[model samples]
Target: METKILPRILIGAPGSGSGKTTVVCGILQALINKGLNIVSFKCGPDYIDPMFHKEALGLESRNLDLFFNDKETINYLLAKNSKEADLAVIEGVMGYYDGLAGKSYEASSYDLARSTKTPSVLIIDCKGKSVSILAEIKGFMELESDSNIKAVILNRISPMIFEEIKKLIEETLPIEVLGFMPMIKECSLESRHLGLVTAQEVGNLETILDTLAKQVSESIDLDKLIRIAKTASKIEFIKPTIACGERVRIGVAKDKAFCFYYQDNLDLLSEFGAEICYFSPLEDKKLPENLQGLYFGGGYPELYLKELEKNDSMKQNIKDALSAGTPCMAECGGFMYLHEVVKDKLGHAYKMVGTIEGESFYADKLVRFGYIDMEAEKTNLLCEEGMHLKGHEFHYWDSTNSGDCFHAQKPLRKMNWKCVIGNENLYAGYPHVHFYSNIKSAERFVDICRKRKTKI
Candidate 1:
């Protein structure tokens, strides 16, 4: 095992809606203005918040999920990704203590903080209450023995009584009051069914980031936050060994419609000798030439129904490629696009790639949302029979035939369901697979692509 001191801090909240994303983005923007090479991470399996960190703020962002990786792997990922960077700012998931099945803090932000030995700053929404805010901080600290809550940032608070609130909190509690963020109405991000409308959809995104950056510069204590971040303990872990193999080309669908992808997944594929060929499904008329494999990650394909349907050549090309036994992996929105028909929220119908035998429609509510444990029921492109993988599912659309190639069970719940249409050359499902959870599965995928390349 190797060891190195890593400068890092986690930005957490008492719960969701406490402006964690906004505050994290603001602080990130503020720090970027000072010319620091910052690497950001989002806790758990969220694919959108990291978009803001990477796309909107121009930082290298990745996901750190306790559920997907063990402590050693998590440490290795942090150390590996944080190389030559000034600081690592991790955005926490949900509440500080909320975790798997809402029963324990097994995979919460606290788990990430404690496991990585990274200090955290809690951002509490102080819109209505002032004195009681201290109580909430105290409660969070008291709830866990190793909460690692080093500082607090008050959100949506008035600047008039900032001094009084800071003094009261510092004098009464053990944590430091960094500063407060006044409510900025114009900088608020819009939302749809699947959390914040992706960073690409926000029209005034640059202006919003600029406004938040100004607020963070004037209000937040960046020096103190840096000091706390520097206090992170050294992490030790065995460096992961990714096998190198024959290079092969893999076409990946990437655009506003098909943009939900884990950066590490692509990185891992690259480490295994797969050359990524990125093509747009929204505007492109055909898939990239000489591709051995196809990967389509989750995004808002439903939003671009008309655009996708109008592009008959693209849809036909994808359908033909999949039909010709090209190894493909599609999840959620990608899976939705493979259907013969896709209906919009207003019940308008449109044509899609007819690889999957079904139609997809908006279900009006989140279906099977949260963490899931998947066991392959048969040999497939990425896994052998009985192979297990950790994944997450958060979607409102349901397909007429979701397939029965894998058995999925909710963690901490006895509920079991069938998902994923897996075979020798495909893995299409609603669940998003984190390749880190099962490295061999990803290696198998690369191997399949390599063999296809040689055959071609």
Candidate 2:
């Protein structure tokens, strides 16, 4: 097996609000300021952290999710994205050990670290406590035999207190204290219903990132951080071979209204010889010309119903394109857009492209959330009979046309439910799929596009 030696560290927290993102943003910008190439990765399914990383370093961040992919795929993606980079900083999910139902380590940051053989630096929030912080850090360090936690970053601590805490921790425990942040309110990022607001929404993100870099560089020890990252073992895995079809053009909806897409999924589509032309459903008048297929991933379509409804040309064009036999894949919010109408909060109904014969009503609460292994109940646009694909669904809306072409089942259990709403040319559902889970799923879509290239 071939191996690649990449210096990396998984930045994790005891839990959410441990200042992990702030510290990560600081470290990323500091490294970038030193003229180093940094590849940023988010451990779980959350897309918001990666947005901050990209905003800080001007580089596209990627995600490594264990729920949607196996360890081999994780290593392949990590190595593929971190190639030739000076350092790889992986920002972890909620807590160090939180995953699935908060009882398993299936998709936790600890799982990511152990699977990829990368060391971790645990971030501890040291507010309103002193010696108890040591207990917190020590407990986390010794929780699992292979904790992968090599160092600690104390948040909301002064230099003098940090020195005392560092002295006590290093003396009593085998862990190293890397740095401490003195709780700067200006360094914080705001959040919303989904999570942190997308990086693009923060108008002064560049300025904020520069300030964070300065603060982190002043507080953290970059030399020790780099040394720890360099200690990561060489990763051994075979990168999956992607089968490419004849070149085909596909339209992808990407905008404020529809932006939840994995970087790997898009890259895999390109690797399979699909020219992905990105357009906006909220602003664009029509789909890209001469397209063989279309992809509309999960996003906040309900938030911009008025804008989407006002764009009559766009809605009619999309409906016409699908009717013309162009293969389409819509997930979550995208699925909502294909309905006759989408009723948002406050009981306002907005007209949508009536591809599916139903309406999507927002239900204030998550209809069905979490990981699932999808088995095609019947052959459709992206899969054949009994084809299994790993994905997850997290949406607040329900459609009257959740197609019965597939049955999505829990990974560690026997529970399953019929989903998706389409035939051989379309597959619309609430679940967001990661293409890396099954290469054939993407290849099949590309093949369909290739076959329909001449007719369109």
- Which candidate's lDDT is highest? 1
Cα lDDT computed for each candidate against the true fold: 0.90, 0.86
Model 1 Cα lDDT, one tens digit per residue, 304-399: 889999999999999888888899999999999999899998888898998988899899999989899899998998899999999999999998
* TM-score (C-alpha) between model 2 and the true structure: 0.96
Model 2 Cα RMSD, Å? Answer: 1.6
Error of 1 at 442 (Å): 0.7
Q: On residues 1-456, what C-alpha lDDT tens digit does candidate 2 reach at each position?
A: 668999999999999988788777878888999898889999887666676566546876999999888998899899898879988999999889987766798899999999999999998989888999989988998899999999998988877788888899999999899988888786676343126256777677778778888888888898899999999999888977776768999999998888888888888989999999999998889888889999998878888899999999999999988988999999888999999999988778889998988899978898877888898888998899888888888888898778898888876666678899867888899988888888888998888888889665
Q: If scored against the real structure, what TM-score would every candidate get?
A: 0.97, 0.96
- Reference-based lDDT, residue 95, model 1: 94
